[model samples]
Target chain A: MSVKLKALTKSIWVFHLAASPCNNCDIEILDLLTPRFDIERFGMQLVGSVRHADAILVTGSMNRKARIRLKRVIEQAPKPCFVIALGNCACTGEMFAPSYNQMKPLDEVVPVDAYIAGCPPKPEAMIMGVVALIEATLAAAKK
Target chain B: MKGWGKMSDKATAKTTIIPIGPYHPLQEEPEFFKLHVQGERVVKLEIEIGYNHRGIERLAEDLTYDQVPFLVERICGICSCSHPFACVNAIEDVGGVEVPERAKYIRMFTGELERIHSHLLWLGLAGHFLGYNTVWMWAWKYREPVLDLFELMTGNRNHYAMFKPGGVRRDFYEEDFPRAARLLDDLLRPLIMFRDVALQDPVLQARTKGVGVLTREDCVELGALGPTARASNYCIDVRKDHPYAAYDKVDWDVVCTSNGDVFDKVVVRVLEMVESAKICKQCLEKLREVDDGIDCNLKEIPPGEGMGHHEAPRGEVFHYVRSDGTNRPVRYKVRAPSFMNVPTNNRACVGYTVSDATITLAAIDPCYCCTERTAVVDADSGKQIMTWKELLRLSRQKTERLLEKYNSRMDRIWT
Candidate 1:
């Protein structure tokens, strides 16, 4: 009932999908929540369930198994969901592209809204990406 | 195809089924296994994967070799340096490019830094899984220095893209050497503190002591390596055995343990972290003493196939690469550390209670999600399943939940 609620409109909830990541990105993503690079300060979170997120944070280059699970995850998310690709692997196949196992850039598989470049972008950069997405969303709302 | 017929022909062949993974209290990832138990122990097990398949391998074929390093490094952020190191090493070998001596030290430095951080991460996770939240919190708290060091070197905590084909992309200046030294020193003190606590903590000992027991014989038979295999008295460290990068010049001991259990593996990693720090210290000294040279000098790759193996945090990571003198490789194969550990999951889980099985499975540090993300073929028909609709649904659910959790729950009623 207060105007303070208006200030919270730009916050975005992110659901991180591993998508056959090497486990390094998965851990760092988790690390973002562990006080040092706390995302909650920016109103970001790694939601356990996909049914509650505004944007999807995807890691790893898509692989066969990751594609299946990621597809399921992406499908589960609501419409107008912002997708952020965390690393170069997810942005493009990277080194595993020539390998028989990996799938190409996550954009080829899912509709991505923003791209954060880094092997695994720092949690700070990751948080910035979220903020950028939220700003984009708020700007869109004004339009 | 071997099925239930492979079971022993005994009078009491009754097997009780216990479903594991797809979410366990202790596990962070999902993998389902149907364990057939006779009495109090497992007689057989049928593994069911496909929980986290994202088609990583299929995706690899489409990326360029230069571009592949970043992707492969993302395969496991904890061991980010290992994958790219293996990939680039193979590329350099096939391409016949000579990396400068200075870059070799930097590569070794990053590799060891990865090992230290990875081991600490595992220690924290293992503690969390064992209900030792104090250790979990403390270990991660101490891990900050290493991450800081990583940031100092690569400008990012994880995914340090410091390596290139000929040598490396990063070069350490004179001033950076002291900063790295100070960071390494800070990391060493906390590491020693955590090491003592991890070894002496009763809860950690009780939860991980006898759980996930992989005997020496089991380790050898299962072909386990790294700390997982070394915990069972397997003195195999690819760095020591194969001498990759600048490991031959670095003086450090390959930490080994006798009892292959969760506790033993924990000890091995803790000790390994110290050893890595020692190697890092040596690396720092070398970095200061080493004269100027190129980190990497890219060259054209020739047509040939070669194998490269490096000891990653989990175990030995092997890569096979073939180049046809092109910017992209003809073939690239990555044998992740988890690939070897996944097979041994059964060895640790069998004959143990369901709870023990869960802890044991986690102790092996199996990346089940990554392992299952691709290769989704029907068992009977071997038919491929398109994942678009399913993924979209999951994405929608995740988005909705995120909105609710963050208190942004579709504020149409806000005004």
Candidate 2:
């Protein structure tokens, strides 16, 4: 049972939080789940709830209304959970930065461990972002 | 009074509230649906959207004619071109700009390709929600080639940004047409299989058929548009009623079904893919027929107000632009299909089980980004007076009254 548990623990469970996204980033995130990208190969599985997540994937810019909800979701996740900002809207706010609806950049509200930058970052970029996050966490653990 | 998420009112008997989002797996955007459930049946559904309120219309008022298309394209990632299709139409209407013949075909081609992509995305998501993971995987696999086609032609998978005021941004190369045509051809086999498999699958029919029904009266009264309306046996297609671009020139029939159930909605969307593919083929043939270089021909604008509506994948995306012969539109009004279609859920979810309500809402293909664009204004004063709090209070009162009436009726039936 411990051997099976150890083997299972290697796979990461990710919770996706869509914070007032136009859904471009969210849809691209789904692309990683679909068979074409097949993120399961990298020991990644998308969990439904934040509590079950090892990592939280934050998509979309931080809008005023959703920012509160974003914080709540982040709080709900298990301790030492990594938050990865996915796409330009989440990473840099992009064209929607000037809007009154937006609260602030995503990194301001949540400590974004890594950023996969694109209008909607391609799935390849997303895989690399997760790997980089894993490496950084490993390096930090070693230190 | 805090926000739509808070359950402040106690006017009705308490029921199990299954709050789906601000963030949920069922939907990609941050819209909340509060369901009042009694056992398995859902008595009421209060939709609290506006989380994805990017303030695009207000932003459009500030942007120039050239920039508005780019801004509006981001309204919904899936319906990326739908907003711009309406935006450019409004601009051209104001300027009385005659788009080149080739541009019309290119617009239609891109628009149909977008329709195919958006519908496939919905199909894949619908599959995912139903716990039909295989369907989700396969539907999305078929969709990859469509994105590849988009990448091939417009250089980006989503947000093609092909639409400009006068015409398309880039010219269609003669070489890409055959390859693009071939890619679209690849989608047909899987689409046919999907339609057949969905129609034949008993489990799917049992889950979806006669579930979340919106009657014809309910559809018209609620002003449901697009597939939501079409599923209800009501035919009101913007492409047919108000033909724009090459839609009038091309020959295609509006796909409508008798039942307004989730199953019929699925059927309508699946059948419509065939029609979109057919239309794209004809548009491609015509594009090759017409001179390729003359994709966009520019003309100057005169002061005027113009309205444009496109039959987006969801429904009609109506854009109203009033230009005072200035570089920017003085007022830009966008009415996405979901703006009207979303309210139909008020009736659609009334009798269905709690489990089925999500699929019913998804059947409308509600784009929260598109629906959250509007703000209430005093018509006489031409100014805003009602605060967001006031609006919430008014809506909550309505919700409370609905809940009270429904629970009281439930008590009578149970007793």
Candidate 3:
């Protein structure tokens, strides 16, 4: 793996972008930071700004109002930014797929590097997804 | 959209219009708040919601009556049980379905367990807002067990999907009572410790006490429900007032405090967790007494309208269902407690500074997404002065200053 890409895996600052989610996945994301799960131990932190983010954690289905903002947020992030779709809604649009208000899944809107699937994925599953994403990035960088 | 245009009227030369949210880091749900600030104090506040509106009510019209419970459960992840419980009750009310006695106890048990977890989650966030990261960590640590209990009982952590029209989808077996009761007993120790810490800690008291004073009159006029109303001694709990599920059978007090401050709200919730734990323990014991049977036997819903309300962790979760003698509901309406409590911020936030305002707004235990970005625009020059990060930094700084002040005062008294 390239040194630059290896460095990226050490500490990934994620900016959470919610697009009208049911909040189950959103809360689970927050739960990861709490003492029990402590995703910070893996050097993952939730930053307040997209500009400071290395990875974007997207939750919920892309709704009409949030679609523009979601696109803008993704665009504003620096290049080499990884997008992780954090729930069933974000990954596939779930129940919101049929709704007129919802636009599309996260992959259709933006390239998703990793997908964590659960109605709201458990914190353990979320951490493993991030780990897998890091491994995938390392593999790609090596080639 | 309705209140966004009106914010311009309040903008004056000295006033800086600070827009908090639409997507801000402090909020958990997406909501927009326009704060008309004169100096550091918020003079007038305008709230614009519907950013999180998913048209769940409209979607419910298409789903069958049985399918609506699962749909309603997704409305708010924290209050998942409340919506489905209320929906089930409403359907039962319409169809005149008699739920088995044991099912009522199971419903109440799960509902109260949700309350315990929801309140703990709010407590953690409240601590985070106050710059007490330890409190946030500890509160969340304690909250995990409650969620674990939820996982054990319902098979899922947040969305149980257990509520049906006439009764619950799952039954709490008689054999499971002892183990469940033990877990609940373990939960009480940490809850009591947290309660004592909140009550005795001077820093928390200084930060919260007399900060967000929503009087009983303002509470009633604004139609505040749940702990927001109970904090002001308004005395309205759907469980106590309406007595749905097995709440009538259980003996528990509605935790209330006369002071309408943020501290009282914290006290009310912390104490309510204790009461909720008690209710859970009692329900588990009652499960042992009742004989096991079919949880629900609801086949069809008749043409009628029924209203059901459950005291969700936030406040009263009201569901109105109109069944047109068909499988699907003609019209279904859900009113989350945050719907009523968010508007009361208009009255509660007038005199407080932005820092205090943050805690005050949070004191209602708002169940929306986190606030992300805030921009301060100078009305006279029409220039943006402060960004979202600056505003959040300012709020945190104010909390630190208050904490220092309170700490020194305590030191002086002790020495």
| lDDT, candidates in the order shown | 0.72, 0.83, 0.82
Q: Which portions of model 3 show Cα errors greater than 4 Å?
A: B1-13, B369-415
Using Cα atoms, each model's DockQ against the true complex is: 0.24, 0.47, 0.46
TM-score of chain A of each: 0.86, 0.90, 0.96
Best by lDDT: 2
Which tens-of-lDDT digit does each residue in A1-143 have in candidate 1? 32332343445676777655565566777787675776777677767677877777777666565476678778988766778888766778665566556556788877788888766676677777766766666666665
lDDT of 1 at B352: 76
TM-score result, candidate 1: 0.78
Rank candidates, TM-score, best first: 3, 2, 1
C-alpha positional error of residue B73 in candidate 1 after TM-score superposition, expressed in Å: 2.4
| Residues B66-174 of candidate 2: C-alpha lDDT, one tens digit per residue | 8999999988898899999999999999877778889888888899999999899899888888888888898899999999999988899888889889988998887
Across residues A46-142, which tens digit of lDDT does each residue of candidate 3 receive?
Answer: 9888898999998887666677678888999987789999888888987767875666777887888899999889999999999899988888888
The digit string of per-residue lDDT tens for model 1 on B161-207 reads 88777777768777887888888888878888877776787777778
Error of 1 at B174 (Å): 1.6
Regions more than 4 Å wrong, model 2: A1-10, B1-14, B292-299, B374-415
Lowest-lDDT window of 10 residues in candidate 3 chain A? A95-104
